[model samples]
Target: MSADNEIVELKSHNSNFILNIFTDDYKKAIDNIKQKFERGSLLKDISVINSINAKDLNIIDIQRIKDFLKTELNIDYKEKKIIKKNTKEPKKEILKENIPKVVKADILEDDNYKTKIIKSPLRSGASVSYDGNILVIGDVNAGAELIASGSIIVLGVLRGFANAGAKGDKKAMVIANKIVATQLRIAEFIAIPPKDDKKSYSGVQMALIKEKGIEIQQVN
Candidate 1:
């Protein structure tokens, strides 16, 4: 935990973590996370991802560095945001109970399941249930909620409520990179994300099970 610190990701079922403060010297990343909160190594949920430039450091200097990491590490301050990455994206993996190489090479490739990784940004009350497969690297904001019995990915921007398979497994699916979620489900089918007036929407969206039911496309 040096070379200017970098524990890129961790979400032990919401015990949360995602350091990575690649030096732009916000006081040398808050004194290298205050020497890893004096060697107790900042546990009990952490979040210090920074790319700076919030009008040159704002939000009361990021709440005074989350109040000095909760008074020098008694740890617990569940939220903070300031992200910006793209060195060609791709490189942020953390599915502890393993199973994600694009969900085992494309949707559980003959099912072996086991994936649950939610790093942050599931704002508005936050909720996440799982039985298998559920990966949200961030943003499910607008009233956050996600239940999964299998299949439910959101690499970002999926404005709320998601209920993939949820114990039914009707070929569960609900991918997203921006699906202004009004509501969504998979097993006992339910969805809504198409009220187009050509609002200039683009690719990378999906919602499975289709036989005149839940169907949303564009995965290219």
Candidate 2:
């Protein structure tokens, strides 16, 4: 940006754009990245079509970088690549049948659902969102959150807030071995207990949203 010649209309026609910045500008870009990350600006809309120069583009998470732009400056940009298919040859149609269908809310029950296992502690500021049952083999600590489109299970502990059925899945539940949550939510339901309800030994507790209210029970 120090260059007296400011950005003008690009010279390449029908070609993808390159920031075309100086290599030293990387430091400034990194500073900007750190600032946005600390702010927890969630970039909702942005995508990565492809990569150009690997050396230049591989330095950062391009998707999150786009998100940072949108979050910090309200800018959404997609760097697209033009792919020209061979028109002369016969078009080979490949069916995509192996991809699993993404599950959403309104399951009516958390039973018969497959639980996703995460073998790590939920660190502060770290968030996880899933479409099926979420089972963490670690603690859900304070200032951390676990949100599931389906049910959630903690193999170790659940101390922070856990939100089940973030996308209107009213039947989603929260199951934890050690319960010490700051708050809890299921579907449109929410609960904030008066004290840190620490469970003795290993116990199984389930949470549900009944009539838009969070309810808990010792199931096992």
Q: What TM-score fits each model?
A: 0.24, 0.47
Per-residue CA lDDT of candidate 1, range 1-220, in tens?
Answer: 3453462222243433544444344565677667665565544344433222223333334344545555666543433333455445343433464333544466644233567777777888787887777888777887888877678888767888887765446677888766778688775456777543435445457788878588877665
How far residue 9's Cα lies from its native spot in candidate 1, in Å, is 22
Residue pair clashes in candidate 1: none
Model 2 regions more than 4 Å off = 1-114, 197-202
Give the lDDT of residue 110 in candidate 1: 29
| Number of the top-ranking candidate, with TM-score as the measure | 2
Model 1 scores what on Cα lDDT? 0.61
For residue 79, what is the lDDT in candidate 1?
34
- TM for candidate 1 is 0.24
Model 1 worst lDDT run, 10 consecutive residues: 49-58
| Predictions in order: lDDT | 0.61, 0.54
